[model samples]
Target: MKLPHDWFHADSEDKEMYGKELNLEMLSGHFLFSKNIEVYAHRNDATDDILCRHIDAEDLYTVVHLTWSMRPEIDNKHPTVEFHGSYDEFLQYNSKFFN
Candidate 1:
């Protein structure tokens, strides 16, 4: 999937406020492979309760759901979130992960 070069660029203040909570670079990397991507934000704190869904090349019929979490710091050793299954199994566990 082709992503806009500026897709990960956020204003300094926006980055300072939410960049640590959700790494836009990592998130964009994951979604680069997605097709028909959709994102929803929580009314209260959009950064804290982000929900995204998309269909990847490996599973055209299944939509993979991803939930983002806030990271205490920028640590590549620890991922900000976790996901289960191969692309194909996303459907089987979709309901469990996503509402």
Candidate 2:
């Protein structure tokens, strides 16, 4: 098992705020700081997607497809998050994005 270090840690405040903005009722600010959320893997390519698991929610895994806004003048905040029920589902669904 990989232990979380500085690299594994995310911006808790931003994540919490994002969760609230998305109306993720289960993912509270406190929950963001807890050990329940684990970001296991990431695709550091063009997609820049992350694979994380919500340990508290029956180990529910999700792939967060981060869309960075290059033109902040036009789009202030980037939105849109997709969720999958299982790891297999997520992988199979996103096969095209990966090798």
In the predicted model 1, the residue pairs found to clash are none
Compared with the true structure, all predictions reach lDDT values of: 0.34, 0.47
> What is the TM-score (0 to 1) of candidate 1?
0.26
lDDT of 2 by residue, 1-99 (tens): 332221133356655543443333233332233345555555545654556677778746666654443322222223334554565666555664443
Write down the TM-score of every candidate: 0.26, 0.46
- Lowest-scoring 10 consecutive residues by lDDT in candidate 1? 1-10
- Candidate 1 per-residue C-alpha lDDT over 13-64 given as tens digits, one digit per residue, 9 for 90 to 100: 6434443344433433443232353332221222243323343434332222
